[model samples]
Target: MHQNNLSDLHRFIDRPTSTWSGRNDGAGAAHRRVHQAVTSLGQGAPDSADAVFIGFASDEGVRRNGGRQGAADGPAALRSALGQLALAQGRNSLRHTDLALLDAGDVVVSSDLEEGQKKLAAAVRASVDAGVLPVVLGGGHEVAFGTYTGVADSRTRKTAGSATSQQPGRLGILNLDAHFDVRRAEQPTSGTPFYQALTRERAADTSCRYTVLGISEANNTQELFDTAHELGADYVVDEDCGVLNQQALLSTVREFVASVDIIYLTLDLDVLPASIAPGVSAPAGYGVPLEIINVVLKEVAASGKLAAFDVAELNPSFDSDGRTAQTAARLIHTVLTYYTPLSSAAPSLR
Candidate 1:
């Protein structure tokens, strides 16, 4: 464990992407954006930053489930796309100069998938202890369980002030996905993360409040729905989150936000329509709009209970012109820009 902890997490870097800035690179130019702006985490890495990005480079879980692979590279692709996103301006009409960013590289997921998740959990706890928001980039939805483990462990320690902290903070998990991902697998996979989380919380005697948005009736089986119902999971189907039923979705989401102390947000790109996000493994036939997605995310961030976040299931293998990566990046950008810590002095800047 010590040796693994000492190693920097990245598994591969195809090449160092350029951070060159152009004379015409205005305040909004993406080429002069995130990649260069986010410092690398290392020996001299800044301990205090607005957010730390942790990547999980593994598709083993997806492969195990016989789903389309390539999500393993989701993090790198996200960085590349995010690098091109304009650094948003603040209320003062100038770029927000207080936001500090760090790239903690990718946590290598080995052939032993469970081992990798343990490492991921450790890394997450370490980051939280250091006091920065950890934005995990996923190799698969399986990353959810690992991320939840990290946050749960950190929150416990935070409240309890010990490794087994019984400090009483509860968690509200918000998943923007098409399927429930509650399949009971002896071996965990992209389809089993939420189920794994539910099991973990039950074993820990901790509260686990869960809600799902954008569920597709045709995609999930009756058994899965039964499992969700039995677990007391709150969910809104794909059609309900669409243009027609916006009011109901908002009402449920508002109530959801008001209920939890801490929020764990996970977004699976497949929840968006194929036309807007065609790069995922399972593209949506009739999905939610980017506008609606952004609205929900921004609202959650505004609630100030968003503790940890992860974006998953981005299969660049099937991407069309990098649309999916861009979409995911946009959501990420929105979170970074909109989230204000319950107690923070200023916006994060490098």
Candidate 2:
């Protein structure tokens, strides 16, 4: 069934307004301005552009947590924060000459697990068909299934009519999180996306190779590690790496990116130390510092082959004075800057 009403899905902000300077001043000005801009621009017409950033905040699983009900508001909050940073960083000044962006709104999911996945898949497929790179923001890690499904669908279409056409190259997943998130989808929660992606036929056919970084020993079940090995994932445990600084992490990520055709980045905020991102679902005691995360993101963006990005598990309700949101906003800004490419002087990571 066609979910969104196409007529209602027109551009959010058709013409730029003079009053609407897409700037993120310190005040909530930028946030409100972007909210209005996107709200006015609305959803894009189907298959509409060269590149797009789709934000999905899955709140279905969050209902299980008592104080985590506000995860649904994550996409908006992250966008607001991103808007402020974009304004501060003058992101509008760096829009790619050839690439246009559309903020495809969140997917409408039903209570039933299968139904929700189906809805999410359809939304992702629509974005792909339109030739948009969907940058998904999530309510939980389970959102990966929907995001990956979108990319996989595109690959499937390109190979569908050809008898001898080889499958598309592997999707390099740079998953920066505290836990492996390889739990089986017995019930389809935040811990299950990677497992489902590896185990399912559609996703497996895409030959998705995962690079799981910032993993805490405490969170890794033997089964998760065993499954990761069985599935051929480059599992990097934080302890085994032994005192890795920011530059070292960037190098490692660069090596991983070189090994794949397209990159899909998924960041679970819990990967950061609780002191930095206390708003996440499961804050690790000792996690990657915020600076290291930024460097990794910069390198990933500079790679120039980033297919999509997802920032997930941010619980604004738990954020203290929006510190976590601010941090995430900065990272998003860095990503945009890395992808923006100012001049010929800019180093190419392609």
**For each predicted model, how many residue pairs clash, with residues at least 3 apart or on different chains?**
7, 10
Per-model TM-score, in order, reads 0.86, 0.77
lDDT tens digits by residue: candidate 1, 66-160: 88888888887888887676664656642343556777777767577888788788777666555566788878888888888888887433463
lDDT of 2 at 41: 28
Model number with the top TM-score = 1
Give me the displacement of residue 284 in model 1, in angstroms.
1.4
Alpha-carbon lDDT, every model: 0.75, 0.62
- True-structure RMSD, every candidate: 5.2, 6.4
Error of 1 at 311 (Å): 0.6
Residue-level lDDT tens digits of model 2 in 241-347: 33455456667787886776666788888888889898876777888777777777777766755656778888888886887887887776667556622111335
Q: How accurate is candidate 1 locally (lDDT)?
A: 0.75
Worst 10 residues of 2 by lDDT: 11-20
How far out, in Å, is residue 342 in model 1? 4.1
